[model samples]
Target: MDYLLAILIIVYVALMILVGYIAWKHTSNSEDYLVAGRQSNSYIMALSYGATFISTAAIVGFGGLAGTNGLGILWLVFLNIAVGIFIAFVIFGKPTRKMGQYLNALTFPEFLSKRFNSKFIQYFSGLLIFLTMPIYAASVLIGAARFVETTINIDFNLAILILAIIIGFYVIFGGIKGVMYTDALQGTIMFLGMLILLISIYSMLGGVTHAHELLSSMAPLFPESAKVTGATGWTTFPTTGSPFWWNLVSSIILGVGIGAIAQPQLAVRFMTVKSNKELNRAVLVGGIFIFVTTFTAYVVGALSNVYFYQTTGQIAIQAAGGNVDKIIPTFINSAMPKWFTYIFLLTLLSAAMSTISTQFHVQGSSIAHDVYCAIKNRSSLRITRIGILIAIIIAVVLAYILPGNIVATGTSIFFGICAVAFLPVYLCALFWKRTTKLGAIAGIVSGTVSSLFCLLFTYKKVAAGLGICKFLTGKAVLFSGMPWPYVDPMVIALPIAFIFTIGVSLLTKNSKEEEIAIEKMFKAEEGA
Candidate 1:
């Protein structure tokens, strides 16, 4: 079986290499490397967007959370479709595409910088993404590596290095074109693998009705530690305003769900398409893809509790030995047939690779295009590839150092920070013609500072984990209370960001030159 699995993996890697080689052959200039030459069809655009949006973070990280936290996490699925896909496409996507084209922006930082006419905005945002995005990338790497370690009986460190090197090859050589082409293939595999897993889980437990009933009836078995944190059951919501509820609603659901709109990696996909028509056509595909994948992962995760309890007289968390990051992987390996394990491994590999490839690409562009080129007033595809290599190394190192059960927490931390730091500025750029460069700068600064302060000083999970608050204040968290520790940083910081952006814009004014550029951007929107 190990030999057979090795052959399957080799075939998969070969296919990815073939695709990457084709993309590298087609890629000639910065335009092709950065935005896939802005000629993507709706199918490719949607798949790339969806695949980049959902990753090991969704399948393994959040899926494991669903096992530990119960079905309450399902709210994220609704928000992912409604906000991440629908609102993002219908409201934000068209304008972003149009403005990006008008500005000739190849990257998200470039898009903002060109819109506001600020080199500071470009380089600062780029620097921030370059430095901070590795945490999210590392979390995705950890998710895939954990699965590989478990399924193949390989050393965990080796799995991380292997996945990183393979993904880095295509991202560095083929760029955005390579990333998207492979994304389409991986997204298809994820959708089908998840569909099969969903069907199999249900059928094994006597179909959906019986499976759900069994899970609901086992509410009494909810872990004591989880109950203390306010988890109610496998099929019901947590106690409102409890720590569990706050984590679920604020960090897990709202963090990734609403934060998806402003992600540098995902936002760049809007510019990959030629027109709003492709964005429009992609809405349904993106929506369905998110729904099927997320819904399956969450449901299977919750149902795994039932499976474990029946088989080993243990709840999901206990069955997986208390690591929330391992529940999904553990459940699959323990409950499924060997043949299916190979397929699911491929599914997870596709998920992790698709997301990490886009992340490395975005990080590389942040360095070479937004920071370096903005400073030097010159472009270099060579520098971009070098930047990608650096990004991969940073992510792999973090993957090694970070503790276990960090997948969901790390994902939310990055997503929440992105929301606070970028969402307000991104919205103002897209919608508010009156937004000024000073306002944009102020917004970014305030949001970033406030979020980091909260994470290091007030958010218990992060502050305690980092030991920063303890070292500085002699407390686990600044506020040793119920809601403050539980509430996500985005809850406090995002509103501050929006207020600063709007208030500062009202006080400040754009220069005539900047005004002319803004007018042209709006005109582009009007034409679209």
Candidate 2:
């Protein structure tokens, strides 16, 4: 079985390398490297976007979470379609594509900088992406690494190191073209793998109704520790008003859902296409892709609990020895046929690599193209490739050091920060001609600082698990006594940033020239 799995993986890796080589051959300039020369078709763009957005975090981290949390986590699946695919592509996609082309903006920060006519916005936003994005990138690395380590029985550190090197090589060599081309392939693999896994699980558990019935019947079997944190069962929502409920709704669901709009990596996809027509055509493909991938994972993951309990007399979480991160992979290893296990492992690998490649590409562009090239007034493809290498090293180290629940933790933190810092500014840049430089700057600064402070000092995970704040505060979380222990920072920081952005914009004014630039940006806006 191991030998057969290795053969399958080797074939997949060869295919990925071939794709990277093809992309590298065609990538002759910075434009091709950054945005695929803005010529990708709707199919390639949509699949790449879906693949990049739905990463190992969704399949491994969130899937494992669903094993314990129940189908309620499907809210994220719904939101991924509604907000992430529909609103993002249909509503924001057209304006973003138009303005990005108008401003000659290849990167998200560059878009903001040119739209607002502020180098400060460009440099600062680029710096933020460079500095803070690695944590999220690391989370993705960890998710894939864990699966590889468990499925192949390899060392965790070794698995992460190998995975990082392979992903970094292609990303550094092929750039966005490589990332997107490979993303389309990876997305296809993930769709097939998840669909199969879902079907097999339902069949194993005697179909959806029987599986869910068994799961709902085990509500009384909820672990004592979980119960204390307000876990009612795998079949129901977290206990309302409990710490777990706040963590689920506010931190996990809302954070990632809202944050999807402002993701630097995902935003760059709009600039990769030629027109809104591609985006419009992409909506259905992207939506179906996201739906199949996430809906299947969450349902199958939740149903895994029923499968495990019946087969092993142990709940999924308990069977994995209390680490939810291990539940999904372990369940597959234990419950599935050998051939299917090998195939599912490919899906896991594709999920991690697609997302990780995008992160590396985005980080590379932010540092090299957005920051260095903008300042130097020259673009160096060599420097961008080098930046990708550096980012991989940093992310690999972080992935090695981070502990359990790293996927969800990293996703929430990055998403929360991005939402707070970029969402208001991004929306205003697209729709509001009155968004002054000062307002944009103020909103970004306040949002970044507030979110970071809360994440480090007020969130229990960082305070305790990371120990960054324990030295000063002598407690895991400074706000441990607050109404909700794990409420995501977006709850507080997003509103503050939005209010400041609106208030500051209303009080201040844009120059006539700047106002004209803003108006020209939206002249082709479909929804505006």
Candidate 3:
């Protein structure tokens, strides 16, 4: 089995290299590297968007959360389809595409900077993405590597390096074209593999109804760690207003769901397509893709409890040795056929590769295109490639250092920060013509500072994990309250950002030059 898996992995790597080589041949300039030359079809756009949006973090990290938290985590599935896909495509996609084309913007930060006519906004947003995105990228790396470590019994550190090297090869050379072309292929593999895993799980546990009934009956066995925070059971929602509920709702569901709109990597996908027509066509594909993938992950994660209890008389978390990140991987390896484990490994690889490649690309472009190029007034593909290399190295190091069972928490932290820092400014850029450069800058700064403060001082899980709060305040968290510790930073910071953005914009008038730029940005809308 080891020899077979090795041969299969080699074949997969060779195929990816071929795809990357093809993309490399076509990528002659920065535009092609950054936005796929704005020539992507609906199928490619939708699949790439879906593939990049749903990573191993969703499958392994949040899936394990489902195993621990139960079916309540399924709220994220509805939001993934409704907000992440439908609203993002229908509401945000058209305007972003139009304005990006109008400005000839190659990146998300550039789009906003051009809209607001602020080099500061561009460099600051770029810097934020470059500095913070490694946390999210590292989570994806850990998710894939954890599965590899569990499935093949390989050293965890070695698996992380191997996955990073494979993904870095294509992204550093092939760029967005390579990322998207390969994403389409990988997305399809992920979809099929998940579909099979879903079916096999249901079939293994008798049928859908019986399997669900079994899970529901086993609710009494909810973990004590979760119960101490007011968990009622696995099948039902946590006690309302409980720490568990706040963590589930604010940090996990809303953080990732609403935050998806402002992610630089995913937002950049809107500019890959040519028109609203392609985005419109993509909505259905993207929606179904997200639904199938996320729904399966959550449901299977929840049902794993039943399988584990029946086989080993232990709950999902216990069977996986108390690591939430290991629930799905352990379940798959222990319960499923050996052949399916191979397929699932490919699924995880595709998930991790598609996401991390895009992440590194965005991070690289943030530095080389948005920050460095904006400062130097020049574009260098060599510098962008180098930036990508540096970003990959940082993420790899983070993967090595981050603690266990951190996949879901790390994902939410980055997503929440992006929401607080970028979402207000992003929305204002697209919709509100009255927004000034000062207002946008104010929003970004306030949102970023407040969010970091909350993470370091207020949010118990994060502050305690980092130990910075304890070092300074002599407490796990500065706040000694129920919801305060559990409340996500986005909850506190996003509203503050919106108020600053609107109030400041209303108070300070746009300059003559800024007014002209704003008008140009909204000219299409005004004409319509």
| Ten residues in sequence with the least summed lDDT for candidate 1 | 516-525
Against the correct fold, how does model 1 do in TM-score? 0.99
Over 1-528, each residue of candidate 3 has an lDDT whose tens digit, in order, gives 478898988898999999999999999999999999999999999999999999999999999999988899999999999999999999999889888988889999999898888999999999999999999999999999999999998899999998888889999999999999999999999999999999999999999999999998987788777798989887889899999999999999999999998999999999999778999999999999999999999999999999999999999989999899999999999999998899999999999999999999999899989998889998888889999999999999999998898899888988998999999999999998899888999999999999999999999888888899899879999888677999999999999999999999999998898787678668865453
- Model 2: residue 492 alpha-carbon error in angstroms: 0.7
| Number of clashes found in candidate 2 | 0
TM-score (C-alpha) between model 3 and the true structure: 0.98
How many clashes in each candidate?
0, 0, 0
Overall local distance difference test of candidate 2: 0.87
lDDT (Cα, 0-100) at 144 in candidate 3: 96
Reference-based lDDT, residue 353, model 2: 96
lDDT of 1: 0.92
lDDT of 1 by residue, 481-517 (tens): 7899989999999999999999999999999988987
Q: What digit string (tens of lDDT, one per residue) describes model 2 on residues 101-143?
A: 8778889999999888998888899889989999899998888
What TM-score would every model get versus the actual structure?
A: 0.99, 0.97, 0.98
RMSD values, in order shown: 1.0, 1.7, 1.2
